[model samples]
Target: MPLKYLTADQSRAARGLLNWSRVRLAARSNLGEATISDFENGHRIPSPRKLAAMRQAFERAGVVFTAGGPTLSNRSAGEGGVIGTQ
Candidate 1:
């Protein structure tokens, strides 16, 4: 299913699953690190376009976003389980 929306906690969980720093995600998503940090910290929500770019970057790196949270793609599943929100 397509992701209808992404939560700040979910974004942080995805980053933890991927072992990605804000700088790396920002670089991959073509966004600024400050933007990512702000979003993850719940200070601001990104525009749809920027959020799409972040999701695409994580998906390309084998992370899958689900209704429950972020999980590894089947291709990378051996590494770990789902990263769920609190």
Candidate 2:
């Protein structure tokens, strides 16, 4: 399945939904404050570690990240099943 990357706005919204302050996120994810600001402001791509940290933070806030595409499990039927659905 093709990966549907999140737009900067969406990313920022997700971060906001997780209630992560820029400083707190930077500290927890080991990212610089300016880097986090740029990412939130659509000026930069977050590093892998920062992405992972964002995912973890969202998880802690009960926000699930779902890919917007088909998965191997659902490829045969073309059903709109989630990638990691049990």
Candidate 3:
């Protein structure tokens, strides 16, 4: 399956669903808070490594991104993904 990237809307929703603030996400992702701010605000697209950091952090917090409906998962699966070399 092709990877499902985090759209800005999804990013915001996911954070809310996880009950996390941007600061928390940044801490978990090991990214600067400003980076997270820019990403969420659509002012920037994170680099692949940074994006992966964000995705993995969210996954660890039990936020799943699925192709179907709004079903959630508790899996700590963080594999087979690449945000590209940007």
State the C-alpha lDDT per candidate.
0.75, 0.53, 0.69
Local accuracy of candidate 1 as per-residue lDDT tens digits, 30-54:
9999999999988998998888888
**Per-residue lDDT of candidate 3, residues 1-86 (tens digit):** 23545665666767776778999989998989999899889999888788778877877766767655443444445422222211
**If the candidates were sorted by their TM-score against the true structure, best first, what order would they fall in?**
1, 3, 2
Looking at candidate 3, the ten consecutive residues that score lowest on lDDT are: 77-86
- Cand. 1 TM to true fold: 0.77
Which candidate model has the greater TM-score, 1 or 3?
Answer: 1
Per-residue lDDT for 32 in model 1? 100
Residue-pair clashes per prediction, in order, are 0, 0, 0
lDDT of each residue in 1-86, candidate 2, tens digit only: 11233335544555564456878766765667787789778787876656666545444444444644312233233222222211
Task: Please name the candidate that would achieve the greatest lDDT relative to the true structure.
Answer: 1
Candidate 3 residue runs with Cα over 4 Å from true position: 1-4, 69-86
Root-mean-square deviation of Cα positions for candidate 1 versus the true structure, in angstroms: 3.5
Residue pairs clashing in model 1 are none
